[model samples]
Target: MVNIIAVDDSALNGSSTGRIHFLLADFEFTGADALHNSRMTFFFSEEQSNSCNKRGVNPMEPACPRVMISGRVKKLDTTSPEYEDNMEAFNNRHKHFKIWVQAHHFYLNELEIENIFIVAYQGGPRTIDAEDYYNAQL
Candidate 1:
């Protein structure tokens, strides 16, 4: 389970995109090791409905944007089709995470979100770049 500790949306004042950084805890560990807390930041942009018009898509509606997740990702067996499925599922989870945050955070809920991007760091923000916490996507 994850718990949101804080959020900062001050970037919205200058751009169409902004970021929300939150702390996550209460991890359910399954292996022999355990983790402390994680700090995740979500970067998102508003929907651009006009972009579809240039592509000649019907109705000129905006296409479904994809969420890009970077850092601490699990290694997949590229030879199997399951890799693709796993990626798709991961993307969906990111979407849900974004929605959940927006629902709970008033400032985020007020934005016209379209694309959600996530970057995670395993340790505290100050030590995120340490050797012990190499970035990956999971």
Candidate 2:
């Protein structure tokens, strides 16, 4: 099964109420930028793994399906004074996000397998601006 985790910031799509799938893949970050926000972080836990497995997606396919993860910050602005005061907390969160991404890579690596492809691009290149999403979180 495809092991996946999703984190979203907007709770739901721009139109939907509660939580929806649209916000889950709205932006993408690369290089050192993904570590920018501590509050905007996501990690894969046992529960997350089980959830993805339940979806019955294959992880070893030549074009493995992509899983988008996004998360929200308590506040939208990352440079607010409050965020500055909690820089330590922010760093911790960022580190956790990083760990999840790394863990996924490591797990796939240990399998010594190929074909479980992960597209590292972001911003929904395949879709319109309004439908775009970040791919770095997954």
Candidate 3:
């Protein structure tokens, strides 16, 4: 499945159309000069690498499918009850996330706690984004 995550999408795209763009700037943090930050940082969890090992696959080795987070919000689509329930489960971690993001070392300031959503794929670590949410509390 192709997953898309739009960052401060308004910067890349003129409007809040919620479209995904995969350019270096869209994912990189150059410095403080750029006021535009998607903040939708992407990464393959340690578990992902372990699973790829079982399949005789090098997670980031050559020939592997591009590892990416690209997709629009699923809010518009009526997902199965199972999916809906799982997504709602994020509320449980809201407190912890809010705490960690505030801690000095690791910072993802662009995220709005109430607006986060998890995108699961390949039966592994789920991608996350706070943009393009439905009925967001933010």
Candidate 4:
């Protein structure tokens, strides 16, 4: 799985070396609305960054070994019957999955989210409004 995804230090550009730990944290899905387009709030301090830092990433830079990834699912814009059906199916699973991210030198920025899904699980929780996600101020 690691081979399929890219792990680099460019994602932690703004972050500096901080306390690092290895731990597991639960991330929930926010339906459509998000604060500053944040998928999830990563408590990196709770997780150990050593194991995932095989790239010898700078400790002074920000990096996370494991973090849950999420994003806003776009709604169907087409009117075709087939597309409508597909959209229905998509909505069923819209925000009910958990994607575990193993980032080496990545941040939550747009360019670095492509590899946040080394591992994923379906049927976790339904979508929630953005107002409910305010607590996760990532």
Candidate that would win on lDDT:
3
- What is candidate 3's lDDT per residue for 1-138, written digit by digit as tens? 123322332322233423222222213343221235333434333344476567676655432333344222222122545333322233232334434323423222222223322323355543345353533452
Residue lDDT tens for model 2, 1-138: 122333222211222111211111113342123236322322223333554356553443323234333343222234555433233332333446446434443111001111122332343323212123322233
Cand. 1 Cα-lDDT: 0.31
Question: By the lDDT metric, which is better: model 3 or model 4?
Answer: 3
Q: Model 3 scores what on Cα lDDT?
A: 0.33
Off by over 4 Å in 2: 1-48, 60-82, 85-125, 128-138
Worst 10 residues of 2 by lDDT: 106-115
Task: Itemize residue pairs with steric clashes in candidate 3.
Answer: 3-70, 3-71, 4-70, 4-71
RMSD of each: 17.7, 13.9, 14.2, 17.2
Per-candidate TM equals 0.21, 0.22, 0.27, 0.21
Q: Give the worst 10-residue stretch by lDDT in candidate 3.
A: 17-26
Candidate 3 or 1, higher lDDT: 3
> Model 3: runs farther than 4 Å from truth?
1-34, 37-49, 61-66, 70-95, 101-138
